[model samples]
Target: MILSGTYGELRSNHFHSGLDIKTQQREGLPVYASADGHVSRINVQHYGYGKALYLLHPNGYTTVYAHLQNFAGEIQKHVKETQYKQETFEIELFPEAALLPVKKGELIGYSGNTGSSGGPHLHFEIRDSSQRPMNPMLFGMDVPDKKTPIVSSVFAYPLGADAHINQSQKLTKLRLIKQMDGTYKTEDVISYGKIGIGVSAYDQLDGAYNKNGVYSINTALNNTPKFEVKFDKFSFSETRYLNRYTDYGYYKTNRSKIQKLFRESNNPLSIITNEDDNGFIHVQDSLDYSYTISVKDYKGNDQTVIIPIKGTKSEILNPRAIEETEDFIYSDHATSLTKGKFSVYIPANSIYEDIYLNIKADGDTLIFHEDVVPIHKNITISADISNYLEEDKDKLFLGRLNYKGKPYYTKTSRKGNKLIAYVRLFGDYAVVSDTVEPVIKPMNFSEGKWISSQKELKIKITDELSGISSYRATINGKFILMEYNYKNDVLTYDFGDAINTETENNLKLIVIDNVGNSATFEAKFFRK
Candidate 1:
């Protein structure tokens, strides 16, 4: 099977925990159990791994199948009963071992595009008893990958304030030349002091054109191992450390991830092993060094790059640029800022290093630096709304500025006269008022229409402002389970549920926005 995303691939905010298997660009593909196991947990939600199932195998491994369309056989029946009993579509259930045991290769579910999925695919993973995800390729789930990894770009960074590369204290992009025998080489580099390297590369398996993540990356200085990182396994708790491991500053400007060959002081990713000086090369005067980088795929196909370095200690032509302001945040200490009606609280260790920030407040807007730096933890921002009337307080929320300079609704909480929001990125924020309610329209069967041959009923629900918060539907005063697909803004109810018994039925739906504005839709239809 071809893979759209590989295990341990670089993603926004975290590393991909599983392999995304391509489903031929469509849905409804039969998914079978990987091994003899019992259903341990079942979760149905609108976000994340929607409609996911966890199976505990006899070998102390748990296999996860996510983004499913529906469960098969008894599993489907059990889930439906639990939903009806709980009166909620989003529910988590754990079945006992004797209740839902299955043999290997048994049909478990059908694959579909659900929960935060970009398209139709299956997100499959294998985790140990401790819940750490391991590469499925190590467990004999093989994809045909004979092609070597392609190194698209290479860069050298002046690690310290005194270090310089190519006579500049900024990161320099090296020109790579393809040599014979399927290898690469870079021009001679001149520098002195500690410096690091980074590379952007991808792997392409046979029969698939998608560029997937490489399996391993290694670097050596003077024939000694400097840094080694393998995508074998990693824990979920340490996944967000990906930002600190890679060149996050470059990613924000270039829109590409460059895997750094060195480790930062606060980066504690278990997948990496650093040698002397944490993978930083200490170039000294009157010395010559040979640096090598090797990129490999899971199938042993590899590509190598060699660079010749000359140690020449010279005067600093271009020094590091520093932006300092009156406000400074120590990485190890908590700091709070208050200006007018806005306030911000940053916890200790929220940043990897101590840095200066340009923070200010203008009326109702708060400018909290830019998005160049990566934050390790969340910081809280609160805006006082005591000046607003009591009637408008419940309809107000905080919005963060997007890339397009437009403010979008953020999850907010209220404490008396304060509207608080916790965020990771530093950007412009302001308080916004949303009084508009959600809009609901019938999709399949309209008012006073007969839907005798329709297999399901659908309605389109949308919110133009603060977004939909909650929704509930009932048929003749009885709750009916309606699956909501937020991607398409469609709410669907299967006729198979048998909720509509009489020839004529009345349907009522109530949708509420995040600002407490509610809208209701009512319609009458003949189903029999």
Candidate 2:
């Protein structure tokens, strides 16, 4: 039961949905059913958990296994038949209650590095009756642990407009020192007004020094509990709220997440079960206040940090300047913006708080914001493309330039004269056109090739711009299963099921890019 990832670990815009059991950097390890259960759901996709199965138990709990290399014979045949019948690579199935019953320790599948998995591991999970994921460690799954959770860094934050930490409005990064008693302490930070704390820390297990997520975080002021964040269980719908749970803006600039001790108004994560006034402490007078934060792992090994903050009314010496902008959008209501040829619609509750929008229009490009504030949902942008030629209208779509200056396609839908795109990120947007079709290069075979000895076929599909949207391949006009590895722009097909029984076989493949531009490939080969 080696762990590669812990349950409830913080990830990019989502929590680690399950515990990743390490398979020793290899795949095809036999996976057994955790308990007596019936298969409830099965999913196959090109990304995310890839090949996954869900088993619902009699005890009202659901166990999940993901990133599988192959399932048991019956399940594999069932899935293959379904994929052929549907003529698609990805499918989700929900069977009847008694359709696929199994006992404990039954071989269900084999682990593999599939979909978005970084390596070969079994991503496992335990969920309640309502499909909410609970920490699998709490279910008596044992992995050795002896090391205490590490508290490496901390930060002090001013909660409100008038709040100041060390006479500055900007956040103050605090340094911690390990005491003789094995506890951590931060030097006093003179602050006034409402203030909160944040920590950049992680836990390590015994025998393995890999850093993992903490189990619990308790923040207190003056020895009174302000809030307690326990990652015992969480719902899937609230998982994306992890971006709001931490300092998202800081994370964008800095790679690591700083878990805020306090909660944001718009964050709806269910991890924090108890809280007092959003875990904020108000200090008005010149006095010393005790701030304590205790972090622990699931094994009960804990680390504590105590910082004494002096509530002094200090004057700001080096205040961070707030950007002056003409655009102001309140978060409570829907906002519509029109600047020259571009229009934007910010849905209500899309932003965490009211923010001054620094927007500008430079010719065809629209600068929405600097990607600083947190956005909860998609913001729609409409760009007028009527000026484009009628032949190029289909190619004119919206693109958002990333920090690296590469423009990625935003999901764009065409209206009467506008290209409407729904973007979840804020950055420079423009009406870009992608007229070039995707490029497909056969890696292992050529036209009129006799490749009876080959076990599989491989092809490289590259789209220099906008990227690939969809791809399909058929042998003798029958759909063939082609596994796409997006990281390498390669698609591979095993040559057993969809091969033609006849001597000669005709293969046809079509690849499409984001802006509807597509390329096709046709080849003839001999199977035997």
The TM-score leader among the candidates is 1
The worst-scoring run of ten residues by lDDT in candidate 2 lies at: 203-212
Per-model TM-score, in order, reads 0.98, 0.96
Give the TM-score comparing model 2 with the true structure, all chains together: 0.96
Off by over 4 Å in 1: none
- Model 1 scores what on Cα lDDT? 0.91
Go through the candidates in order and give the C-alpha RMSD of each one to the true structure: 1.2, 1.7
lDDT of 2 at 470: 92
Instruction: Give a tens-digit lDDT track for model 1, residues 293-315.
Output: 99999998999999888888888
Best by lDDT: 1
The superposed Cα distance between candidate 1 and the true structure at residue 447, in angstroms, equals 0.9
lDDT of 2 by residue, 182-225 (tens): 99999888898988899988988765666789999998888999
